[model samples]
Target: MNKKNLRNFLFTNTFFIVLFLGILMVISLFISSNILFKNIYDSTIQNSVHSISELYNENMKYFEYFSSKYQDIVSEILDELYKNYINNIPFSSNLTIENFRKIGIFKNVDYYIINKNGIIIETSYDKDLGLNLANRVPNYWKKLNEELNKNNKYIEGISYEIKTNNPRIYGYLRMEDGNIFEIGILIDERAIPNFPKTVSSLNLNFIKSIYTYNISFIPYSFEFPLLDEEDKNIFNSLEISKGEIKTYTLRENSNGKESYVYIKWVPDKVNNKEFNFTVLTKISIDLSSIVILKNSIIFIFIVLIFFVIFSLALYLNYMTNRIEKPIMKLINNIESGKVDADAETNILEIDTLIKYYSHLVNTLVEKLKEEERDYLELKEKLQMIEKEKDLLYEMALKDDLTKLFNKKGSVQIIQKLVLNKESFSVIYLDIDNYNNILEKLGQNEANDAILSLVEIMKTIFRDRDFIFRVDENEFLILLRFVNLSIAQKILKRFVDALKKFNITSDKPYKISVSYGIIEYKGQNIEDLYNEARNKMEMMKMKKLELLKKLSDVNAEEN
Candidate 1:
């Protein structure tokens, strides 16, 4: 409330209010503009996908038409070759190479005719004429017969020449009387230029057989010049099946350009024989439209925000000066060692804030004093509740008489060990004659004897070992990091100690424990416990047999 201090506070507070308003306005405009830009981008991608789908459908129609026409022409040529056959002449010799050459079917194909004897009786290649094809290719006729038997007259597959290992597409016909007329065409990618139909970014491939239907094994494939190395890579990776259309993005390439690719697979059957073809298309994308629109909208929005903020700031500065003048006078009076009556303002909110701030100061002082007294009282109550909770938990988990973990607690610990895959052994111990002791010394004395046995086990076993009173007369011990021999050694020491340990009861009693221990590998706790119990029953049987023998010897001596 000094003159210099008041002036600095007034200027700093006014500057911060202006800065905060400006930031809020800018953020509001930015968020709205970003949401609008995202909507425009999503709409663009959806439109592009629609357009590309229409283009793909149109191109596939042309490919299907041309393939069907090619198959029809081949069938006609085969009929013409058979028309010259006579009943008296051998079937293969009736259709000579000259007849096939004249029919225009062999213009781009090497023609041959093979008889049932598996000999090429007529061939366009003079060297192959009269060659025993069955001897040369034992499985060739077998495969042809298999296809023909399935009612497929026209079959196409990859075949190689007997003399030269050159590959060719062997499209053949299976005539009656077991005579085969075959046409082998060397694949030329440019031979069927119209199959691709000169569409930009469109590539076509004609696969001869069903087995070579994918890009990796295509017999004939052609790529348009518009498809770059990146597009080719995307095409190669495609795994389209028959009648499938797929779309995916191609990432940064050698030139760091990205694009989208679409592929389709078409399959057709001609005269009961199947053929497959695949089409791949790619298109480049540009973000110029979205970027330009976003930038222009953001610029105009920001200008509008600036105008609104500027008008608001001017009006607020005028009001701030008017309101703070009275506040400054009130502070000065207080600093000059005078008690203020009140601060008044015409604005209702500002008047209310001043009134409430004074009331809040007095209320907070009283509340602090009240809270201190309540906190001390709550602290004592919380300590007592925590102690009670601890006692309840211990009672739930521990046996009342022996203070060993009960069945529920022991099972929980075993489940944790199994989950952790820790190596341990379970030793099941049973009291040999607990019922006899109970009959002789009553319930309380028998209970004391059992407690003494638990104490003896505590002294004999390590602290880490978990001891449990899991049954009425059974005590289970889980020994960690101990093998069968180590567990046996510990149990032996427990029995020896129990023989001499005194049970604090009205009558003296000697305790004996029969134990069965099994080292755990990976079995469930139930299975391991059952196995240990079985071993303890066996030990009990052996001890009974020894006692019977001793009794008989004493009888004979008497």
Candidate 2:
């Protein structure tokens, strides 16, 4: 064909090729972008969850610690009430309240005492006195009473709605002398209020403020007005379980435009039953700006790749046209059994092709007298040389023993696959006790065994799959677009094949192989390889243990 025909053929066949490549490029870009975005999202969520959990935990610890110290103070107060009032003759109720008030003077907490019948006999806060505590006793107290009845000490995290606009945590102690006394400590919510704000401030200079709520589901303190109508609805709708983290969104106004609000729930302790406490923090990401930036990047890359490919195609078409035209004219003349006396071309390739055609036509005339033997021999020799060149190229990139691709070839193929961003699986295989086998059987038998193994591998693996010898005793197999189950099936087949082979020399032995297979989904290649290698090592160790047991059994029998 002439150069024009050649160009036309390529353009026709590769029309789908270019279109397919373009679609692939777009898909690859989208997948890469999605992976990067997911990584960012996961990392953000992880860090936020960790920080909020830590803050809630520390806050709970502080509250528990403070409540314990307050318990000691309550013990002293109860002892005084028993010694100075209850045990003394003609017990004065007024003296108890007055002494309790005196005891509260040095303490930083609000305190209250209830009688055996659940009456608020005395309280440090004046507004609480004479209130019937029977109706207000927290559920935790009832549970605690059950425990105490069974002769167990009662220690619990309890929550109750106090008279103030806030809730309070109380530590209660039932005295041995039949009077029940409770010590109420208004948990200082503000002690760790700034924690979420501190974390929100990190890498988020864009966030204006942060808010934190207690386990009571009350917005105790916040750096900003945390609950808008929608946010409140979301919070109310949350069905949080213990130690579970949930995320929600909110909307806010910033710079006279609407912004996003993010809230996350984190538990203080896994076993905590009373309160599903969470630390809620919010930030506004400029979604419109991010969309615009992402679109701009995609547009730029598409334009760049399109222009480069288009230019290269044009250049190749031009060179092909220069070579094809003269060659086609010479071929037509030879087919008519006449020389093209007027044929001439400025291009060197075109001129050479024409001269070759003329010589071939002259040879054909002579071959008619010699039965075309010389021409057939010359063609056969040319084919052999081409085959040898191809063999050399393959040999340069392959392992001699396994006849599989070497390290360099494996890396090259993997890099190309990565660029395509297609899903694939990698299986790393190590022959268990390969060195010991070599030592027992010697090098000659070991080589025969390896060659036989290569034959088995070629039969098991598909033409599309890439098998490589990565180390002395390890083979790495790359399976494209395959899932874990398919990779495992192939590995099982390989193991089965090895089991069928029995190579014997000085010592008869069965081949043993251990493999680790990993199905990747846009994970880092090196990390995936390391994970697979670790699994392979674990498998190898198990096999070695089994082998050792077998050996011990044989020795005992002998």
Candidate 3:
């Protein structure tokens, strides 16, 4: 409605947008920080889980290296037992548990003979007698059955005695009678030469260095120092879901720090690719520092971001003030009839707004041109009436015979256009040998010839062009909006038309013309007319010289 109202409306919308963008930026920053820190926490926890899983694999290497030496003895004992069973020898008569211990390789080994029903029917240790292994540990029973399905293949698993809780390295082999031959070697019997202790200590140090607060190892239900089928399922499920044997979950810790529990599946790593089972490994990590950093980032960025937005809001209002005044003034000026075409505002908005109402501006300009046209028409009518009065009285404005303008009227018309800086061209024409035509033909025919020439000139030129008989046989033509080359073409058209007329004329002599044309070049009409006369004289001299050359050529031919 008004400049003030318009500016206030723009300011209100601009402020609302700035406030909306500012709030949006703060929210996005906080959300981005939270997501970034959460990813960092998850990545750290996964790393810790990998490191501890690798440590477990490294410790198992020591157990494998030490236990392998005893593994050869158990294999040799199984070869002897399989041979006896093949020869149809009864195990009850030939090989008692005491008799088997008498062999040098079997003395340190405690062997259990598990029948097809998974019951330990025979054993070197009395405590393992009549034990149902399938019921107590079904996971281990399944592993023992897999070993029995193969020919002399064995797997080593560390298990504690069921009743006594003594640690043992157990290996399983299948008998020829579909029974499992299970053997155990005491950990005290096979020593790792301090390597396992060093590895264990290193693992503890590495875990402490990684910021793991507490770790618990639970596989399915109870903690067992065994890699079983359940752990492999967890490993396979994680591998399928995550493309690796690792997964993690987030939780709040008791001490108000953020915690992540990472579950990783570690393979038995026996032959690199063949895994009998996998261990379900869990690692707990803290992210207190990461949380603090995220909080600080949110706080500091909010303050800095809000400060930046406040400055922008002020700058927007300032720029609005700079833009409003020019546009209002331009709009008011455009509504009026006067326009300053050379006015300076140095603002693109004002110039653009002026052009925006182009229809109204164009209508105003056309109305002014219509008024000027009417005034010009009235002035031309008055000049015509004044010329008629002069023609009737002294024959000074229009030539008495041809009725075209004479020198006095022609001078006034051309000088007026020249002072107005209009573009035009002038052609000066001289009728060749007009006096001879007048002497040979009578006065009436000569006048009729001049009148015919005038009519020809009138027909060739536009109504806007002026034709003047300035001298007795010389005429001048003023052609507006015509350049020098265009006037020359017009002269050529008139010459061709005259040549056709002469061919068909009944007169005794032909009418020929000498012409010269020049364009106005910021000169007064008098100087321009004189220059045309000089061009006409040059044309006549050129014609005379051409005639003399033809006469000399004819005399030479004679």
Q: Scored by CA lDDT, what does every candidate get?
A: 0.63, 0.62, 0.66
Per-residue lDDT over 391-425 for candidate 2, one digit per residue giving the tens place of the 0 to 100 score: 99898888887677887788788888989987789
How does model 3 fare in lDDT? Answer: 0.66
lDDT of 2: 0.62
Give me the runs in candidate 3 sitting further than 4 Å from their true place. 1-11, 52-69, 76-116, 120-131, 149-167, 172-181, 188-269, 272-278, 311-558
Cα deviation of 138 in candidate 1 (Å)?
99
Clashes of each: 0, 3, 0
Number of the candidate with higher TM-score, 1 or 2: 2
- Number of clashing pairs, model 3? 0
Q: After superposition, how far is residue 248 of candidate 2 from its true place, in Å?
A: 8.7
TM-score, prediction 1 = 0.35
Predictions ranked by lDDT, top down? 3, 1, 2
Best by TM-score: 2
Q: lDDT tens string, model 1, 228-298?
A: 56556766676553433444443423522222434544433334444433444444444455557667877
